[model samples]
Target: MINHGKELFSAIVPTEQKGLKRKIYVITKAFIKL
Candidate 1:
């Protein structure tokens, strides 16, 4: 059970990180266009 929770938590962290990275990438592109 503990292992399962840890895996779930780890998986969520990466997806959240990727989401933040993608948002930053889009913002950067917009700023560059301006």
Candidate 2:
């Protein structure tokens, strides 16, 4: 359903985006520190 897909996108996409951002941040920080 179109509504279902939109709901799924709203719920899931931002969370995954934020998680990946945090991971990249940590990795880059560790790299810089070392």
Candidate 3:
């Protein structure tokens, strides 16, 4: 059970990180355009 939980966590973290990075990129781009 612990190993399965760790696998799920590893999978989720990268996707969330990618989403956050994209959001930051978009915000930065908008700020630059302003």
Candidate 4:
């Protein structure tokens, strides 16, 4: 159970990071347009 939880957590973390990076990229582009 602990191992399964760890795997699930690791998978979620990368997805969250990707979302965060995308958000930052969009914000940066908006700033550049200004």
lDDT of each: 0.60, 0.59, 0.60, 0.60
Candidate 3 local lDDT, residue 19: 89
- What TM-score goes with each of the models? 0.47, 0.45, 0.46, 0.47
**Off by more than 4 A, model 1:** 20-34
Q: Put down candidate 4 lDDT per residue, 1-34, tens digits, no spaces.
A: 6775565556556667679776556556545655
- What lDDT tens digits, residue by residue, belong to model 2 across residues 1-34? 6775565556555556678776556556545655
Among all windows of 10 consecutive residues in model 4, the one with the lowest summed lDDT is 25-34
Candidate 2 residue-wise lDDT at 10: 61
Task: Name the 10 consecutive residues with the lowest summed lDDT in model 2.
Answer: 25-34
The digit string of per-residue lDDT tens for model 3 on 1-34 reads 6775565556556657678776556556545655
At residue 15, give the lDDT of candidate 3: 56
Clashes of 3: 0
Could you tell me how far off, in angstroms, the CA of residue 33 lies in candidate 4 after the best superposition? 45
Error of 1 at 12 (Å): 0.2
TM-score of 2: 0.45
**How many collisions between residues are there in candidate 4?**
0
Cα lDDT of candidate 2 equals: 0.59
**How many angstroms is residue 33 displaced in model 1 relative to the true structure, after the best TM-score fit?**
45
lDDT of 1: 0.60
